[model samples]
Target: MTVLEADRLSADSNRRRDPISSRGAARADTVLAVEGLTVGTGRADLVIDVSLDVRAGETLCLVGESGCGKSLTCLAAMGLTSEPLIRKSGRISFLGQDLSLLRENQLAEIRGRDMAMIFQDATAALNPVRRVGMQIAEVLVVHRGLTWSQAMKQAVELLASVGIPDPAGRANAYPHQLSGGMNQRVMIAMALACRPKLLIADEATTALDVTTQVQILKLMKELQAETGAAMIFVTHDLGVVAEIADRVAVMYSGRVVETATVDDLFERPLHPYTRGLMACRLHATTTSHGRIAAIEGTVPSPSKRPEGCSFRPRCPYASDECMALPALRPIAGIYGADQHRAACHFAEDFARAGS
Candidate 1:
């Protein structure tokens, strides 16, 4: 089925049925909710007051530049952030429990069992020396306490489930022996071993070619439907967001500058950063410029973030009032209520002018 058709089916099913988490079996209406999350070194905050929610079986895409804290936010959610160097504050709720309060051992038990992550560059994420099957089996052995043979069998099944050919043979191959796409399929298999309720895919397709990216995305959507796992997908590609996301959160420098449904975000972007990102798309325009249109200027470094809107320096609409940081405000435009939000001093005016 087409992506839109699949999305419609998923949405309809979500409304009619209540799916429970496979791990804790809590009343799984909300899978993950990150509220007022702050991540930084003890010296200063790198990511501030970022809040987002992923409903059971929904896909919330976090789209931004490389250093916009997209990966950092997800890392914190998974409790994967390196301690001492990285200090995380705020709530990361998974299946209604605050992960920030959990001990490291407890969090590890909950992570793959209740939540999983598909890291970027599957090659780097996988172990070079270990057989792929052994690596995938590790999750099952650790989380499900399966015997070595049983876990290996399950690992092969997981590989096949993600569309890898000859799972039995592939499982025995090392990471270096597999193609980029095949390795990614292995990563997905490993992540799904414990049937986690939440999947944080941090650029899961970044290292693959176009065809492989599509295949991996399709596989992920199928898995999400089969398992009813909520996904928080982090990526720089708007095209991927257009294909996979139910809602879009646009981040800049460390904060979420805008959050809206994918349709609303593209139809009527409320934030300047969102607009700039949308403008960079080459999918819609018949451009012969031989270059992908890019958002001008790099995202400001965390240590040197501007006082005003983080996007103000790159934004064309900056004004004198923009010297101060703009709070995320609700303004009347397109998406109603919680669907539309933007951090800008003259968001309403920008909307009016654009309209």
Candidate 2:
């Protein structure tokens, strides 16, 4: 079967399963399913042909470098892409409903009610002039048709739920009055206010200190468990994915290079890009240099994307076959045996050769 056909079958099978259980043993359904999503800007496709799914209560992470198009994918999903800037193609289904060709009115109706996104930079995302609580209440007022007073009350509760102390008083304070961590909590609170079926956190903890990052991630997980909201976490941090993700989709250039469970990715990464990311992340046990290590070269610009595997330019294992675009193919051995796939011609040989 073709890639698109295979993805459709996977979605169909998962839809029939309803793995996430509810009260009294009822089942909560799959929350989001995206297939063949291509997002671009200015006639140049930045990210191409991405496919993945998240059942309610599951976390699927998109991990890669800055230019790998993680943030653009989230933006496209919610219809937040600026006009004439982001052009998107392909199927984006939420609750088995397609969101790809939705009009503004339709998208607005679902943006906060069924889906919400936590932006990358928390401080900048929250309005400086408005009180944080008021901003959270806006979604309730706009979508749920709640009175301002009622929404504000629930907004304070939401803030408190995200571990914001003295939420009632803090709610009235402007964004600038809060610290970085607190602002991030407010963003989370706003995103979770409606108990959205799917939450997209685009590098939500990037700006915070390590301790605060941990706290925020823990809070997010707790919220997800409580509400059973599926999450699409976009980040460059493999360390963060190790802590939170059930499955990971590694992107390079505009496409997914590798996808596997968190353990599978760390232990037996199949794609060259995945392997490079792992190698770059490994710290030296016996080192002569104390400097932080990094992957060499840069991700090519979207306009200048290579013909073959996007990672071929940077891949240490590149060969003549790397000149041809490699489709995502199933690997012979892995944890998610049927699910394990790598877009490389030499994945098996690379594994045997211990790359």
Candidate 3:
């Protein structure tokens, strides 16, 4: 999607829509609602008390540095978490169905049909030997119960829909033969084959070149608009967020520090970490070489996530009030329209600081 498209949507989106915490009464419009989600091993919590929701036809971008629990959150949402890491507490409801209450057999029925996911690495996600087309056709065969030949025919159409040239020829190509971009497109085709109502993309465009990344983002937007599939797009790159997100959630060390509409976030970032990220983006473009402004410290280790705010150590605005973790609260006076929220004790001060 282009900047113009993003700006138009940002302007048109109802900025007054409340954050998930306040929208419990009207979750009927929500496609995926995650509340108080905690993912961890017995020893430590990797993702703690995180909550966010994706409504019908909207895109919610999860942004943070690596190890901020972005991918783990997606893994938990999709029931793909391994045995070592368990969902310690939380509720993940997709289309009003409680995912935790579903059995493995029942979950399988929804995995590809009602909800689908695209991994960050396309090369590893695709089978090395199987034809790309067959991989997609398999989803249709399993979910739609289409015959082998019928599924194969549909696979070609799916590839074409995602902008792959000579769909029939590319359909038979092996993963090893296609470029990274082609394989990524193949992965998308498989994910969209069933036309899932909810789609989770984990940094889907990170591996491609700029041109291909733009193409893929545009294609995802177009396809999403056509299908009205609510999306949870996990990405650390704010550039992607600007181009695609309707809402943005900033996560810090296993927790969401801020949640706001894309316009609100770019205009007045409340958390220090979020402000630092935007600074980094500006420095990267205004100058070249080694002078880029970056957040001072790495994300805190989950096991030792500090006494108060996890970002306090790196935050320039930290005060004695930050001795305890701040609740994710909506800005005061913005009552009823509880959409913009921040977890910083000094969020109001920062919001008033201005750009």
Candidate 4:
């Protein structure tokens, strides 16, 4: 099926599956809740007030151009932020446990076991000298506490599950021996080794060729369905977003500018930044001589961001009111399983006109 068709179907199916329990009072299935998350260096805040929710069995796509803080938000959520970049202010709860309250060792114990991440560059992320199977088995050994022998056997099986051929033979090979796609599959196997409740894929398919990218995406969806793990898929490609995301959160200049169900965001993008991104997609209708649309200025540097809306300088719709930062608020007259929110002063007006 086409990506758009797949996206629509995925959105419809997701909408049908309520995040709330049968009692219908609360988000009982929420696997990750990140609120007011701000990550920064001593110099300046790089990620500002990002909030996101991913429910069990749902995929929330975080999309934006590079340097928009998509990866930083995920890193902070995973309690994996390193020196110089700390979680400035935020509450990150995974499966009802506040991450900030946990000790480093405690958080480490929970990371590979309960939550895992598939980073963008598998080659860089994987240990170059280690055998692929041993690397995959390491997660099982560390988190599941399986014997080395048992983990190796499961690692081979995991490789097979992710569509790697000659799983047993490949298991003994170093990362350099395999193709980029194979390395990625190995990464997926490792990430899913413990059947984590939340899987964060940061630009996971960004480096693969189109065919390989499609295969990786398909494998991830099938495995996620089988394991029933919530996923936070980060990418700059909206086409990928349509294919995999049930919900999408658009980030611009270190903040979440807009968020909605995949279908709603595509049908009626509220924020100027969101609309610009959609317009940048190369449609079949574009002729040979047609120029591709693009959002004109670069994302502002964190320390040099304009006083008000970080996006206002590049936003075509920006007005004098945009001098003040707009809060990410729900749009009125648009009701659904998920509230549509936009950090734009004219978001309500745009919604009204769209309706």
Give TM-scores for every candidate, taking all chains together and pairing residue i with residue i: 0.90, 0.89, 0.93, 0.95
Off by over 4 Å in 2: 1-28, 282-292, 353-355
Clash count, predicted structure 3 = 0
Backbone Cα, N, C clashes tallied per candidate: 0, 1, 0, 0
- Point out where model 3 deviates above 4 Å: 1-21, 283-290, 333-337
Deviation from native of the Cα of residue 20 in model 4, angstroms: 7.5
Residue 188, model 2, lDDT: 93
Best by the lDDT measure: 4
Best by TM-score: 4
Candidate 3 lDDT trough over 10 residues, lowest sum: 11-20
lDDT of 4 at 121: 90
lDDT of 4 by residue, 1-355 (tens): 3764664575454343443232112377889998899999999899999988888889999999999999999999999899989888988888888899999999999998899999999988899999999999999999888999999999999999999889999999999988888999999999999999999999999999988888899889888888889999999988889888888999998999998888789989999999999888888855736687899999999999998999988999888999999999877877552468899999988888888
List runs of model 1 lying over 4 Å from the truth: 1-28, 288-292, 353-355
- Which residue pairs collide in model 4, if any? none
Estimate the lDDT of model 3. Answer: 0.87
Candidates in descending TM-score order: 4, 3, 1, 2
Sort by lDDT, top down from the best? 4, 3, 1, 2
Q: Write the per-residue lDDT of candidate 2 for residues 54-156, one digit (tens) a residue.
A: 7787788999999898888788777777866565677777887777667889988998888999987888999888999999999999988999999999999
